[model samples]
Target: MRPTLLAVSHGTSDATGASAIAELVALVDRALPDVDVQAAFVDVQQPDAADAVPAIEGPVVIVPLLLSSGFHVHHDLHGIAAKKTDAVVADPLGPDPRLADVLAERLAAVPGDGQPAASTSPVILAVAGSRDPRSLTDAEGMAHLLEQRLGRPIELAYLAARKPDLRTTLTAHPDAPIATYLLARGFFFDLATRLAPGRALTLPLLDNGPVPSALVDLIVDRYEAAEANVI
Candidate 1:
């Protein structure tokens, strides 16, 4: 049986956030190529987890497009999918090889195209914070990736409730003239939050490009493994 895909997101009360989650379904369609794809929300939205039950006649793969393996990724997604508990849940996309490529691409595609002049000093990698050790470790792992791909030292910055705050990140590369954020799911930075002001240098998240391609491969690998087990 062809495994079905149900991507559950931490749904938001805001329409825009909800729309982005919906867009992810289309993204998976492009990645998986001809597989049935469904979308669900863990909260504050319709077509909830129960809605995915009838969408698949075969095994199902539950993917969480969240950044960290926090409460939502670890517990909430599981709780909602309890009825379909047999489904296989893929790990969150963090510190994956593909993400490294995405970060490099984001930096290279900067308005100045990564010209030496664009970076007057070093680079700062601003990320959404997490209390999870896995996420923090993943953030630390980014240093190796950024170093190899970018051929420059990159420092990690926390957007909220975590260590190595933006100040620490800024301090890491004491004289960097240009700072950029490598993130998923939002427009470079979440405009809805005070975390980011409208910086002209800021660009969109890992959009349709090498990043998406890498993201898809990682997701598909997870699916292939799950499919072998009929999950």
Candidate 2:
């Protein structure tokens, strides 16, 4: 039987946060209309892991809609994985090429006023907590992708762990600040917007907003591209 795709997030106590996650879930649902897709929060929401995991009718591919590997991705997800006797744990959405394009597109979203990208803006690839080393790789990839797409430079910043905090990263750069988020917790991630006086904007955790249809296409492509692998 075909597996069910679970788009999981850290889940927040705020009502708005839950709404945002739900919005992303809807986007993924619309993206892969043919597949059996559902949403679950590792915390702060109903249907705990025990409730969510065992109910799967077939194999489940848990696609964490998160940016980097953190406690949630590392410990929580791993715990869930240990219990998933019937499901397949897909890799966290870090380290994916489409992510770069999505982030580049997010940077492109700032109201640029028709100015040349190279002349007008620089971006901070803002990520959530970052203990894992792979976060750096993902950040670096996003930076390169943004540069290639916009003909400008972009730096990396972490909201929690790692060096170069958001403020410091912005100060290190000479160009006006723009933050492109690469994380699952959208509301928690969006705070970076306030930190930037220039223009702090974040891409939606998923969907890519105006380009929902395009993101849906990418999801289809990813599904088609999915091969036999254990993560």
- Give the best candidate by lDDT: 2
Model 2 scores worst on lDDT over the 10 consecutive residues at: 222-231
List the pairs of residues colliding in candidate 1: none
TM-score of each: 0.75, 0.79
lDDT of 2 by residue, 30-75 (tens): 7676778888878778766547877887667776656555666667
Cα-lDDT of candidate 1: 0.60
Question: Candidate 2 — which pairs collide?
Answer: none
Model 2 error, position 186 (Å): 4.4
Highest-TM-score candidate:
2
**What is the model-wide C-alpha lDDT for candidate 2?**
0.63
